[model samples]
Target: MPEHCAAFSCSNRRTIASRARGITFHKFPKDKDVRKKWEVALRREGFHASDTSVLCSHHFNQGDFDRTGQIVRLRDGVIPSVFSFPVHLQRLEKGRATSSSRRAEESLSVASQDSQEMATSSPQPQPNDVNISTLNVIS
Candidate 1:
């Protein structure tokens, strides 16, 4: 019987070695029971198993790994897409800023329209009667 390793470091070291060379190695335990245990551990740490191989911190640093190679486990227990926390947050922030700016622009447009209406409705003095008496008094 093959001995089972409980620590992830062993698998991680091997994964790193494989990734650094741009090659995949099947060093991880292949037994169903061993895989089940690993899967449980990975899930506990917010990881998901999909058709593609699972990667640890070591695999992430490798040259062969890219955004397309990453994975995220969704709330519905499905591995939906690639995982990049920084990228995700940046997109969210940008969207929020854009929405806020749009709202501000709309409000400004409405205010300008109201101001125009007020200006148009207000009474205007005739040119000949405009402020001559006030100017004389000031002089």
Candidate 2:
């Protein structure tokens, strides 16, 4: 059987054309956690990567590769991040990301307010006090 890409909707296979296009296949990581992350990134419901399962280079950012050697390799802990997910899956991912980012922004805002309140409440300049306004201006 011809080896094929395991990602959903991916038609890449090991062939001369694919090689010419710089498409390389990567095996699922041996570390269970990293492997699971790859599977989740695929967004295929209930999908589990078998030992022989592979994802194509098309599903990863160019930065994900380590090319110091003649052979290309995925950097340790790298998870495939690119995909052409269906509209419904894309919408779901966007919704989740939006909510998560909103929560993160809220947390950062609250922290900033707390820091400002603490700074204002201090009547005396601390020995360690550096001007935040000056830092902001320099930035």
Candidate 3:
């Protein structure tokens, strides 16, 4: 298929041959220290692999690199962690704002309904007895 996957040694050969040809490969380290460094870097970059037993144990033992410089089986199928404090706060603020707005709208609606009812129930002013000349002068 593609030039990159055409190489027989490429692990993604089958995937590349398929209709969905995109394959992302991660490089693991052979050196233990280097592997640890890579795992630490991933952790720093908000990759929460600590909760998973497989990833944590692998990274703890062999770092991220195996004997062949390939990424270890650890941390496979783990969803990327999101560590955005600002985004979380923004979501909370938006929720609060929406709730407050809804409450305010409900209060306004109730007040309007009350006013409508009052208007409907109250006695209307008489056209003949009212002082139109005084009302015009005040306006």
Best by lDDT: 2
Please provide TM-scores, in order, for all candidate models, with all chains considered together. 0.25, 0.65, 0.24
> Per-residue error at 105 for model 2, in Å?
8.9
Query: Once model 2 is optimally superposed onto the true structure by TM-score, how far is the C-alpha of residue 121 displaced, in angstroms?
Result: 40
- For model 2, residues 17-91, the per-residue Cα lDDT tens digits are 899999999999999999988988998899999988999999999999999999999999998999988887774
lDDT of 2: 0.89
lDDT of 1 at 101: 89
Candidate 2 lands at a TM-score of: 0.65
lDDT of 1 by residue, 1-139 (tens): 2222223333333344556764332223345565555465443355434433444333222443343535521122222122333432333344425878889988999999999999899977778876756775644
For each of the candidates, the C-alpha root-mean-square deviation to the true structure, in angstroms, is 16.4, 10.2, 17.7
Off by over 4 Å in 2: 91-139
Clashing pairs in 1: none
Q: Give the candidates in order of lDDT, highest first.
A: 2, 1, 3
Question: Per-residue lDDT of 1-139 in model 3, one digit per residue for the tens?
Answer: 3322211122233343432443333334445565455555344344332321111221123332243545334343232222223342333344325878889988999999999999999988886777667775644
